[model samples]
Target: MTKLIHVAAAAIFNPEGQVLLALRSKQQHQGGLWEFPGGKVEANESVLEALSRELDEELDIQIDHAATRPLIQVPYHYPDKSVLLDVYKVSGFSGVPHGAEGQPLEWVDIANLEQYDFPAANTPIVNALLLPQCIAITGNANGTAEYVKKSVAAISGGAQWLMLRAHQLSSSERTALARQIRATIDAADGVVLSLNGSVAEANDCGVNALHLSSDKLMVLNTRTEFRGRWLSASCHTIEQLEKAVSLGLDFVTLSPVKTTATHPEQPAMGWQAFSELVNAYPLPVYALGGMTAEDVDQSCQSGGQGICAIREYW
Candidate 1:
């Protein structure tokens, strides 16, 4: 029988939409497969404190300004023992990453993560890496195809993922246009597509993924009946992020990373404050709202998956 243990882990992403994975030394348990850099949480140490300490020891790098946000806290069993892992998104840090612990490490781009096998508990975490940082089309009132085309151009111009949010349109119209955009994305062989709603239908379609609305994400339950497809959500609160984890979401958006013209009245959490909130849990979190690729370095500092922008990247 396996005994349960508790530990903390970190999913560290870089500015180029890649994440850091470490290969344990031959002396360590689970010696071959790669893992996010972290270790068992010590008594009396806060999760973030433990994360910072572990990274410094294991990687031999100072966490000069790292945002170690709690992501998903889950229990996983290895044949001999089980562990309650405290996962965090490590947004930023200084110095080149070296395995001071004598382990090998790789900085993997999102698309390349599947190449390495990870522990079963970290499987969901791996999928989270594949989720896109959506750049939504700002104007739905205009012609759908034209707007979508522009979005595609933006995607070619470095925007990798997009969400077609025709919120006010009737379901049928939205579906029609979304389908067209889906085809366009497919033809391009580059950009990924996600629809705002109708996931059940989106599943039937060939689009790369589905983006759940805040309302829909709230009432959802059970892991989405999906495999090999990315699922994402818009989360403005901690509660929503929890629900997303429960629903087996691939990744989530922590929005308004900065105050933006998009939502003038809504207060932005800024990078530092958001990092603290994120430090509370471990999940693949994107720093959404008024962010750009330039903010990527900063966002990763806050434990973010990457930056999801409106005016910034788009």
Candidate 2:
């Protein structure tokens, strides 16, 4: 087995939401590529300790550990080495960051990160950083009219990302609802709309993204044929999450993090277990089930991309 080298990295963010990235030295491994500022973890140090040390050594800045939120841990295999990157979002820090090791540093807007060349393993990290912290899901509204009204309200109330979910509706009915919601969101100028349906339905409805059910996710061997559309999936167990990652879905929603009225009998995976489950998986994960907008920080702390909710978010 290839031994995994553990690395601690920080996605240091300025107040403007731009992430700090460093240009790798040509002499080093993965040379000339842009990467998050970090280094290999020493044998005896904790991930957090290593992150703090690496920032201080590489950037000459003091990291505020309290403000550090767990992001994603990606395991990537190279021809000569394998690395398990433990990444964190550093929202609070002291001192201006400058490259102390002679590597160049730049603050790039999250949306424009794709314009820069990054290692293949850094792709999911970029996605997680760019995605919204709250994903509002449309609940069981009484009718199409009610659903449209709620969708508009959700967007107006600051939901930049939304998932139109009406599993009980027929294919045509779901497609129509998705189209209606997409129209409303587009008019709002910046909100992203993801429809909860099949690839064919999403294409027919002209939606911007597709959210697959866990069942559908498990059966897929590759990504769907929706070109230019973002793909996401619902996940429960680590097996489902692995499947979603293998399919290269943009993100995933891990459900029932907390017990809900809809499924009182289904066991709730408390925050601790949720954190453990998503600890090192690369794909961004949204904590779903009985979540509210207020849980966003806690979700991030627990290694989730954000919180996804229906009633509470709407």
Candidate 3:
């Protein structure tokens, strides 16, 4: 049996939501086809450790604190070799992305990853990236923490990832609340603590990443200072999605997978429609727009990393 090459890669996105695709040398097997920058995993290193090392050696870039965003774990197979590709979003790097392996490079939008011919093994990865997601902050009502009593209750029930979309709180008040949630979430690796609209608050609160509205997403493009954080955004259309991509957002909420009870007045893009829209998307997408944890498995089956739901949380 051929030994599987442990591999890692960086889907480095530019300010336009375009990903950096390295073109292979004419001598390579997948010559002329484009790919994310990375290389084979080495011995005894964690996948992330290997990713960091490989990116530096392969692209001559440093994986700084903010750009180190996890995208997905992919499994691919070739005639002679099998590979497990641990991919990440290089959101913040010190230098221009280059191909240290002597391959040419191009930065393509995430939606275009499939357009360029990559190895067959990378197909699933391409899909994982295109799916949209929505992370709901259960227990909070209409962007205000009534008491945080409901928020506490919801987490106990099942909501693993919670965002404090508390719009009404004063900065000091919200920061305190986020810090409290962070303390609670620290124990649950599966649970993430995210904050709405404030990178400074998130970093100070010690949460996971930032969730930006399309408005906010647009404002932050080309700004690499992360406050040492994970970043996400909200997208309604392909255009906004590109902005998120360019900014190197860690994740995002692309909503209304189903006709949402909360937003019934708003039109919905059914599952088929959502899948079609997301076809060939290049980043990890969580099926948002009215989905639940129960729907997560189905979302992955359809074309997403999983489903992110506000209603089903806890």
Query: Which candidate comes out best when scored by TM-score?
Result: 2
lDDT at residue 51 of model 3 (Cα atoms):
75
- Choose 1 or 3, whichever is better by TM-score: 1
Q: List RMSD in Å for every model shown.
A: 6.0, 1.9, 14.0
Stretches of candidate 3 off by over 4 Å are: 1-136, 141-152
What is the TM-score (0 to 1) of candidate 3? 0.56
Please write out the lDDT profile of model 3 over residues 1-314, one tens digit for every residue.
66667778877877778778787776776666667778877778886788778778878877775656666665545676677777776677787777787767787877666678886556545655553343557445533344355566656776656777767778788888777666655776456677786666666766656676678777774535456445777777888877765565555566677788768987877777666555434455677766766786566545456666666754
Model with the higher lDDT, candidate 1 or 2: 2
Q: Residue-wise lDDT of candidate 1 within 1-314, one digit each (tens)?
A: 55557787888877786889998666667767889889988889987788788888888665644454544555566676777777776777877889886778888887788889887678756755555444544444478757666777777776667777767887777777778777777766557777777666566555567778888888766545533267778899888977886776777788877777768799988888778766554466778777766887676555566777666534
With candidate 3 superimposed using the best TM-score fit, by how many Å does residue 142's alpha carbon deviate from the native? Answer: 11
Model 2 clash pairs are none
Pick out the ten consecutive residues of candidate 1 with the lowest summed lDDT. 132-141
Over the stretch 128-222, how does candidate 2's per-residue lDDT look in tens digits? 88788998888888987889898889988888888888889999999988878777668786689998888888889888788999987877667
Deviating ranges (above 4 Å) for candidate 1: 1-112, 128-138, 225-228
